[model samples]
Target chain A: MILTVTLNTALDITYRVRSLRPHTSHRVSEVTERPGGKGVNVARVLAALGHEVTVTGFTGGATGRVVQERLASVPGVVDALVPITCATRRTIAVVDDRSGDTTQLNEPGPTVTPAEWSAFQEAYEALLPTASAVALCGSLPPGVPVGAYAGLVRTARSAGIPVLLDTSGEPLRRGVAARPDLIKPNTDELAELTGSHDPVRATQDARRRGAGAVVASLGREGLLAATRDGRWRATPPAPVHGNPTGAGDSAVAGLLSGLIEHLPWPDRLTRATALSAATVAAPVAGEFDQGAYEELLGQVVVSGEASAA
Target chain B: MILTVTLNTALDITYRVRSLRPHTSHRVSEVTERPGGKGVNVARVLAALGHEVTVTGFTGGATGRVVQERLASVPGVVDALVPITCATRRTIAVVDDRSGDTTQLNEPGPTVTPAEWSAFQEAYEALLPTASAVALCGSLPPGVPVGAYAGLVRTARSAGIPVLLDTSGEPLRRGVAARPDLIKPNTDELAELTGSHDPVRATQDARRRGAGAVVASLGREGLLAATRDGRWRATPPAPVHGNPTGAGDSAVAGLLSGLIEHLPWPDRLTRATALSAATVAAPVAGEFDQGAYEELLGQVVVSGEASAA
Candidate 1:
């Protein structure tokens, strides 16, 4: 069973308006709501692809309840979030039709007290024995220590479960030190963390920081991965031209699924690109297009590393 | 007992930040969540001030469940909303500290299918006998006919209840024709409905259009009411400068509290002004300040019309 942790889950709301005039009233033509956050999105795609997954994090108040209820409704999803005092955050993506760009408004996640953090740690430890792989996604909420994910990674490693850490900033920095099996960082996140824009060099720097493997998701350019077997790059066919909100999470899902199934490096990259493209091509918010996934699987081209032996 | 109907109730979230930038990330310093909507706020303040209040309309889905759970926790409060398939809306209030002004991002309310509307009508009718006064508040959600509020007012009137309608646009236009006992339109809403910027003339026009009485909430200047006795202008103690987010709803709470207690028009205006000022002074997101209310009560001035006496 695959386990995902979303310390700061959100009830994501997207509103489509003709044009965005800040500080003014707007009559929204359409509105969409979904349970969202990096880990939640990853778990959803995996479940849709028929993977047994459990999502546990800190969810509280009404928003938290809604998130839990939504996870339950989705097939192959197990919700494991520990309750907290504060309500979970909500992230609003206001899409402007004229510009075709989304203006994001995010709420700072709820503060998880020391006791709540301890409770989550206990829950994760309890579930670690049965989990084949664990994916830690998103940022740390207030009152939670910066190295929270690092502690979880260490615990999962001690239990002999592969940990896939995908987060930015210091959380990634600290979590990498625990030597997680895999880390997925988008191009911007890779640059910010390693202070290097070159994906290949940044992946090497991240591996030196103690990550077993690094998969860098470069939005349109596609996925570049550095593993023990060799390095590989996969690109999708043309541009899918759709909302790229959960594309990276979908890539993470694909890579993790391939790892457990023991697929070759090139095949892993193909699935990763296919899933990422499928996420963007999906019409519904937070859903992946299965038809696109099947069509895209054949279209992704995987290239071997120029330097790898 | 005063009953307030918010067809599209919401979980009002206010995030306090230094400044708001479009397409850029913000770290909110303070966050607050409250059960909200025009009628919900009215009921909340009335309950806080020791008035019996019930909230009715359509509330369902997980968000709706949270609304009911939270309202149940508040003392002196009752709820009668019918269940619906869609989740209730969430209104985001972004407060910029530098300017101290609020930018509101409201979600379009949930769509109420014809079956859902029938359920709401049935539930509201059954509860009317228990309410001495009923208030129809906020805008109508999509799929609800324009004359929806008007029909609700007519139903309440037939049950011998004095209906107070607080809404805007077509809902307000159609609702007033049902001859609600009072319709409280803000200065802008009054102008929009009557096509007159002049408050006195606007109130007269609103009354002329079938509202038994017109009470226009004039920001900074307090409330202007045209009643059977005369036209009265209520002024707050000082310009209680704060986010005026829910001040109008607070005023409605005071007015309904006064009506239920059989207070004179002057006293009602005084209470309304005090409550509105208290809301500004409260500092808490959705609560009115009781201390401010007590202090402002003595400072409120009610001056009657020159022509009516």
Candidate 2:
């Protein structure tokens, strides 16, 4: 089973209006909600791909209850979430039907007391032993140590579990030093981490900072990998245009699932690239179009030339 | 004790953002939640004025639980809410800090099943015996009979309780035929009900259609009241400018409280006008500045001119 940790889980709400004009009242034509966060999104995609996934995170208050209740319906997903004192946050995306554009409003997640942090640490450690691979994803909510992911990485390594860390800012800077099995940084995150705009050079620099392997997502351009054994670049047949909200999480799911299945690096890269493109082509996050995924699976080109990174 | 019935209750959420640009993302800086609906807001204002207020409405699901929990904090306000199969609605007001303009998105309230409506009616009848006065306010949710308020008005009247009906559309038209003790209509609602945009003629037409008394809210111009005893027009000291969202609800609270206190027609009109203006001058809904209420109380002009109506 794959284990994913989301420190800051959210009740994702989407409001659809005819036109999202500033300073005007809207009769939201429709509203949709789902359990969300980077790791939760990753786990959902992994489960959809026929992997048994266990999700651990903080959930509290009414919104948190709703998230857990919704998660109960997804098959092969275990809820090992820890309860907190404060309610979970809600992220609203206002979709304008006129222009098909989305405006996001994100609430700052609940603050964790010191005692809650220790409890979460215990829970994470307890869940780590039964997992073949673990994923530490998303932002560090208030009251959590900035280096919290680094400690979790060490724990997973101690348990002999393959760990993948996906985060940005100071958390990423600190977690990279713990040497996770893999790190996926998008173009902006890579630039923010290594101060280099070029994906290939930044991935190399990120590896030098201490990552077993570095995979940088370059948006529509696809995934670039730099590892100690080799370097490769995987590209989709064409640029897929749709909501790219959870594309990176789907890519993470692809890589983690492939790792557990013991696929070669080239095959893993192909799956990751195709899954990312399929997610981008789908209507919502964490869900990929199976038709698109199957069609693009055979078409993704992975070239390993040492200079590909 | 004042009893206010909100058939369609809501969890009011306010989000603060730097600027609300369509098609762009926003990092909401602040979030605030409150129990709200027209009757709920009226009850809150009455409770703040030192009256014991009981709020009854439909509450179900997680959002409904949050609404009930929030009401527990307000002193002198009792929650006599009824449970339903569907969850109560949520109303979100996105406030743009840069422009100070709010974009409102209101969810259509839950559809009340037949059994739920019967249960709510039973609850309302049980609470009516102890109420000094009763207020039936706001829109009717889906699956409820449009003439539901008319039957409620009859129930309150049968119990010898003075009932005030505040709503719009077909419900308001049918409710007027029941001859509710009082009916409060704004300019637009009055126009739609009486087919006249002129407040004076529209108010007279509303009374002629069987309302015992009619109070017409003229926005900045204040209130115009036409009762069996006499007719009067109450105007504020000056044109108060601020959020007018809950001003009418405050006016309803003022009238309800004054009716229970045995105030004269002119005195009731003056208090209603002052409270309405005070609520408008305040920063948020359902709250009145005490100083503004006191200052406007003495200055409100209640001219008992026959030509006022």
Candidate 3:
């Protein structure tokens, strides 16, 4: 079983309009709602691939109830949420029909008190020992200590569970120091973290910072895997265009599922790359076209290189 | 006592950003939430002015609970919501800091069942006998009978309560034949309803259809009130710039407050115009600048003209 932690979850609301007029009234053509958070999205994709997944996070108020209910309703994912005092955050995506672009308005997520963190840690510790791997994903909410993900990674390591850290900025910087088994950062985020735009160089920088392996997701380009076995790149069969809201999460799901399936490094990279491509091409957030992914997986070509030493 | 009906209420959410960039992420500078609907906004302003207000409408689910909680928290307002299975709608306002303009995205309200409408009608009938007037406001949700407001206004008239209808689309078209004592239509809505851009001619056309009085809210230009007592044109001292959401609703509150206060036609027109101006000048929705309104009320010049008929 894979344990995924989404510290800050949201009720994602997407509105479709002909065009986004900055200061005008618009009649939206449609509205779509979903449970959103990096880890949740990862778990959704994993469950779709028939992986056993447990999602844990902080939730509160009516929006929290909505997130929990929606998460539970998804076929194969298990929800384990810690109750808090504040409502879950809401993320609005305004899609402009004419330009096919999206404008995201995200609310800073709810604050989690020290006591709530302690409760969450306890729940996580109990689950980690029974899980194959733990993925710490998403942003840190207010009131949470900046090094919260590091603490979670340490606990999972203590339980002999391999931890995969997927986050950005401060949390990512701090968590990387704790020596997680894997760290998945996209091209820009990789460049931001390592100051190197070259995928090989950035992956090397990430691994040197204590990540045992690094999977770099390059938007439209493909996936780069830097593991102990070797370095490999897998590209999708064709380039696809759509909203890339959950592309990174889908890659994380692919990487984690690959590990659970005991696939070789090359096959794992292929799977991650194909799934990420499918996610980028998906019409909605946190959902992927399985058939597209499967077809893409068969076409992925992985050329190997010596591991960074 | 004044009665306000928001058949499809909302939890109005506003997000303030420096600019709206499509398909890009934005960090909201500020956020505000208020209980809203056309009638709800009217009730809020009236309550601030120290009027006895009872809101009678269909409300259910968590969103409805939030609305009820907010209304209960505000002083000088009473809630008498009839229960329904559907949750109330939510309205999103995205404001651009540079342009000082708002982009409003309104959700389709809950589908009200026939049983729900019947229950709501019973609740309205129970409240009408004790209320002095009724303000029917906002769009009718799906599953609600198209002429829902017409039936409601007839019930209010039977109880000797003057009904004021404020809505648009088919609901307004159907409800007009019920002969509401007052109908507050904006300039464009007035043009759409009467098929004339000229406010003076359009107002007479509105009265000819079924309204006893037509209080046309002409935004910055001001108020045009055609009543049994007399017709008056009231304009503000100056055009105040700010978020104008709910400004018309505030005008409805001012007009209703004046009627209960026994202010003459001219005084009522002036007060309503000032309140509308104050609402437009306020930084937030459902909030009016009392000092500005008081100052502007004194400057409002009410002029009269004999009817062409």
Candidate 4:
């Protein structure tokens, strides 16, 4: 079973209004909610791909209950979320019907108490033993130590479980230094971490910083990976134009799933690139188009050289 | 007990962001939730004024649960909300810290099924016998008949309970014809109802259309009323300005409480005017400043003539 950790889980809500205007009241014509966080999104995609996945995170209060209830309905995904006292945060995406633009309002996640953090670490360790691969994803909620992912990555390494760290800023920098099996950082995140805009240099610099492998998601351009086995650039056959939300999580899901399946580096890149493109093309956010994924999987172009070492 | 009916109850959420720009992501720094709807707001103010208040409405789903839970925490307020299958709506007031302006996003209330509507009417009828006065407030949720408030007004009257109707549009129009004991319309609602921007003419016109009495809330100018006892204009000693969000509801609470207390028309007007001004002076959106209310109560100027009869 693949394990995904979302320390700062969210109940994502989308509201559709005829048009958005500042300081005026709007009547939202539609509302949609989904259990979300980077890891949760990755878990959902993994489950959809027929992988047995367990999701662990801090969930509490009414919003958390809604998230858990919705997560329960998704097949092949198990909820192992740690209970906390504060209500989980909510992220609202207000979509304007007129221009198809979205204004986002995000509430800060519940602050994790020290005891809750300790309890989460214990729960995560308990799940690690049976997990084939683990993905540590998203931002750290307040009150959790700054080096949270770094410590988690070290634990997974000690347990001999492959882990993929997908986060940004301090967490990612610290997690990378813990030498996770893989890290998938989008272009902005990669640039932030390595202080370089050059994709190849940043990806390689991330690996040298202790990531076993680095896959940088360059939206539309696709994935660039530097790994122990090889370096590869994978791109979708044609540019897919749609909502890019959750595309990165799909890439992470693809990479983790391919790793568990023991796919070669180039094949993993192909799957990751195709899945990311498919997610962008999906009518609904956080879901991949199965037909697009299958077709693009065969069409993704992969070019790279095997590592000389 | 004073009974307040919010057919379209809501979980009112306030998000404080540094700034709110359209189509841009905002990180809300603070969040506050309150049980809201015009009736709910009235009930809270009545409860704060030491009146035993019973709140009944259709509540369902997670957001409804949150509303109910918060209502339960209010000291003198009783939650008698009827259950439904659909979730209650949420109204988000995004407060921009930089500019102190608020953008409101209101979700359309749950579509009340016929069965649920019937159930609510039954619950409302049961509560009416014990209620000294009933207040029908806010818009009718979808699926409720347009004449819902009219039917409810007639029911309360039949039970010998005076009903105060506080709503706008067709609901208010239909409810007025049912001869509710009192109808409070703001300047805009009055204009819409009577086709007259002149508050005195509109208020009198509203009364002739069937309201036992008409009270027009004229923002900073104060309250103008045409009642069986007299015609009066009540104004605060001076303009009280702050957040006027719930000032109208506070006025409704004051009028209802004074009516049940058997206060004279002039005294009722004074109380209503003071409470409205105090609500505006309060730091919080829906609460009235007790000190301000007490201070303003004595200072409110009421000038009127007793009806010739």
| Chain B TM-score, candidates in order | 0.95, 0.97, 0.96, 0.99
Best by TM-score: 4
Q: What are the RMSDs of all candidates, in order?
A: 3.4, 1.8, 2.3, 1.1
- Which portions of model 1 show Cα errors greater than 4 Å? A80-86, A113-119, A191-198, A237-241, A281-287, A291-299, A305-309, B113-126, B143-145, B155-159, B191-198, B235-240, B285-302, B305-309
Off by over 4 Å in 4: none
lDDT of each: 0.87, 0.92, 0.86, 0.94
- The true-versus-predicted C-alpha distance at residue A27 of model 3, in Å, is 0.9
Residue A165 shift from truth in candidate 3, angstroms: 0.5
Off by over 4 Å in 2: A306-309, B306-309
Model 3: which docking level applies?
medium
Q: How does the DockQ of candidate 3 come out?
A: 0.67
Candidate No. with top lDDT: 4
Candidate 1: true interface contacts recovered:
0.52
Name the candidate, 2 or 4, with the larger lDDT value: 4
Q: Which residue pairs show collisions in model 4? A: none
**Which of candidates 2 and 3 is the stronger one according to DockQ?**
2
lDDT of 2 by residue, B98-136 (tens): 788898988878989999999999999999999999999
Model 2 accuracy (lDDT, Cα): 0.92
Tens digits of per-residue lDDT for model 1, B117-197: 988888888888889899899988878899999999999999999989999988999898889999999998999999999
Docking class of 2: high
Question: Over the stretch A1-309, how does candidate 4's per-residue lDDT look in tens digits?
Answer: 999999999999999999999999999999999999999999999999999999998999999999999999999999999999999999999988998888999999899999999999999999999999999999999999989999999999999999999999999999999999999999999999999999999999998999999999999998999999989999899899988889999999999999999999999999999999999999888899999999998999999999787
True-structure lDDT of candidate 3 = 0.86
Residue B34 local lDDT, model 1: 70
Q: Which scores better on TM-score, 2 or 3?
A: 2
Residue pairs with colliding backbones in model 2 are none
Isolated chain A TM-score, each model? 0.96, 0.98, 0.96, 0.99
Compose the digit string of candidate 4's lDDT tens values, residues B78-125. Answer: 999999999999999998898888899999899899999999988998
